[model samples]
Target: MRVLTVNAGSSSLKLRLLGPNDEVERSTDAEPGVDLEEVLRAWPAPEAVGHRVVHGGTRFTEPIVIDTGVRKELEDLTALAPLHQPKSLAGLDAVTAQLPEVPAVACFDTAFHTTIPQAAATYAVPGEWRERYAIRRYGFHGLSHAWCSARVARFTGARRIVTAHLGAGASLAAVLDGRSVDTTMGFTPLEGLVMATRSGSVDPGLVLWLEEHEGLSPREVAETLEKRSGLAALAGKADMREVLAAAGRGDAGAVLALDVYVHRLAAGIASMAAAAGGIEALAFTGGVGEHTPEIRARAAERLAFLGLAVDPARNDTNEGEITAAGAAVRTLVVPAREDLEIARGTRAALR
Candidate 1:
């Protein structure tokens, strides 16, 4: 099946046409206001299209063929993923308008984590709030985590694995027997590891204190935490590469930011290992995970207690199976391939 995968981000739209064997036949990262229909017309027409929807919420647990009803349901989920859902809808509308005859599938980033057990997904909150709001951990980056976990399983034949997706946004997933048992992201993408711009896992009381004592409005607090915090707040830059460079130049803030980032990352990995009972394999994906060897090395050093070690040579190489010989846990790097995962999901749903 030739599948065209559509991934909509905050600032760009990614379109990839995959051949039957899952090779990328054509692809493009179109910025906002690009003529999507014209772009689609320029390529070999895809037999089917798959849209990467960010939040499936509690209802849509799997990929389904997009239709009038499904589109409405997705719109209803906008509140759950305010930053991403609308973009997804816009992408879907544009592509479907271009190829109305072609079948379209909605492959959700939240779908893969739907297998998370109730206990792990639930929050320790009031029953009324939990019931009324449907408040629970709905981990993001499922498409990346799903692909990485399966790739690790294929490489190491390990059923217990932890896959870290570390890019502008980051999260860790604990996959046991090919199912997501637990993950770092919860309820929203803002709940996990310190992102490029997001302050992850802050105390609820601090928000309340800022609102009450500091006289900051709820919107002001949210904007600061979501946009002005994290590495940007610490190092005055959001890109990890710049942060690394500054730290190397003896910048105190960048050094502390890197330390805090690695600390939270290692701690999250350890927690995921606990969730999966033990870690047989550890896989890293996303920009920082694949490109920044220093981040991986620092994380490995901190997680040495879990038998995680990376050969300096292989780590520098930044390729598969960077794990040292005889290590109890196998660690490797997998490039993020959410497009391929969406294609796979689309084929499966159509089948």
Candidate 2:
């Protein structure tokens, strides 16, 4: 079935019309202020519409048909993913408004990680708080991770894999036999490896201390952690490419930023490997993961203990299996394909 996938980001909306054979028949990236109706009118109406919803919370674990109840539930989840859920809802509204007759599915980023075991998903918090708030790890970037893991398994025939989805935002998933056993992201997208702007895995005590001693309001703390931290705070630039360039120029801050970034990434990969028992294949996807050979090489070097090493020439090629000869672990670079995953989920939901 032909499916039109809608992926809404903080600043842009990505629309991809996939043909029955999964070819990208047409695609467009609409920034804020673009007329959604006009954009939809320009393309052929799709038989189905699939939306990339950031948070499905504890309720929705798989792709489901978007209906009055589902829409309401999704809206209620806005607080869980305040930065992304509204944008997704807006995109859903726009597409359904343009083609109300087409079957629409809400494909969640959290769905794939729903299989994570309780030992990994549960937080070491008060039972009352945990039960009342449903606070647990609900991994993000799962659609990308799912696609990468599947590709890695097909390419290397590995049952245990670690898939890293690195971009403006980043996370790693430990997949065993096609199911997510553990992941870096937790509760929200801000809990994993250092991202473009988000501070990953900060101490709760530090946040409370700022509020108690520094007298910073909750809003201020949130804003700083979500928008003013990470590589941006470290190097004055959020983009990895720019940071790498600055580092190459002997910029101390950029060099330190890259070091910390890779450190956290490698450590997270090790943790994921532990969760999956061990890593047989390491797959990289997303913008930085696919294009930045330096980051991949650095991460591989750190993970050498796990027998993960990339061939210098293959890594430079920036795609496909880049595993070094005689290495026990295979390494691959897979382009992010959330649209295709969304399409697959849409077809399954409608079927």
Candidate 3:
């Protein structure tokens, strides 16, 4: 079955046609408003369509055929993931309209994390609040994590690994035997390791203090953390390349930002290892993970305790394996491939 996968970002739309066995027949990158006919004109008609929905909340845990009810539920979830949910819904609408009769599936990024135990998924708050709000950790970047887990297993033959999806938005996953036991992202993408623009985990007390003492409103706090903070707030920009450039020039703010970024990243990786009992390997994906050699080296140096030394030579290259020959635990670099996983899920849901 050929599956056309749609991943709509804030400014761009990515389309992929995956063959029955997951081979990419063709792909395209177009502006967000491009017509669906243009995306499909170059390829044969797809048997199905899979969309990358960022949030499913608690109700939808698996890929399901997109129907009227599913669309309504997704619309309801818009507030939960204000950044990505609307774009995903818009992508779904485009594909559904273009191929009205095609079987469409909603492959959620949160679906792969449904396996997290309640202890890890639950927020430490009042039962009343938890029950009333359905507040809990719903991990993000799960499709990337799932793809890393599967690909790393095939490459390293390890049952337990910490998979880091580091990019503009970053998260780590503890995968045991191909299942997600625990992950870094929680309730929202804003809670986890340091990201490009968003501040990761911040104390609840600090948030309350901002609202009460600093006289910042709830909306102000959200906007600050989600957009104004992180590397951007620390240095002057959010782009990792620019941050690194400034850091290289001995800029104190950039230097401090890099240190804090790597520190939180190493801590998250170690936390994930603990969640999996012990780490047999570590897998890196996403833009930063696959490209930033310095970030990987810094992280691996801090994690030397786990014997995860990266071979400087291998780390410089793009091949999957990056671990030193004698390191106890392997380190790998896996490029982001959420669309492939989306295709796999869509096929499974229909088959």
Model 2 lDDT at residue 195: 91
Question: Taking the tens digit of each residue's C-alpha lDDT, what string does model 1 give over 304-348?
Answer: 999999888898855688998778898898989999999999998
lDDT string, candidate 3, 1-351, tens digits: 999999988888799989888899988887855776876776889999999999999898889999999899999999888878999998888778889999999999998899999989998889998888778899988889999999999988999989999899999999999999999989889998989999999999999999999999999999999999999999888999999999999999999999999999999999999999999999889888998999999999999998899999999965478999899999999989998999989988998
List TM-scores for all candidates, in order: 0.99, 0.98, 0.97
- Give the residue spans of candidate 1 off by over 4 A: none
Candidate with more favorable, higher lDDT: 2 or 3: 2
Q: Provide the RMSD of all predictions against the true structure, rounded to 1 decimal.
A: 0.9, 0.9, 1.3
Q: In model 2, how large is the Cα lDDT of residue 15?
A: 95
Cα lDDT listed for each candidate: 0.93, 0.93, 0.91
Question: Relative to the unseen true structure, what is the C-alpha lDDT of residue 204 in candidate 2, on a scale of 0 to 100?
Answer: 96
Q: Residue 225, candidate 1: how far off, in angstroms?
A: 1.2
Ranking by lDDT: 2, 1, 3
Worst 10 residues of 2 by lDDT: 310-319
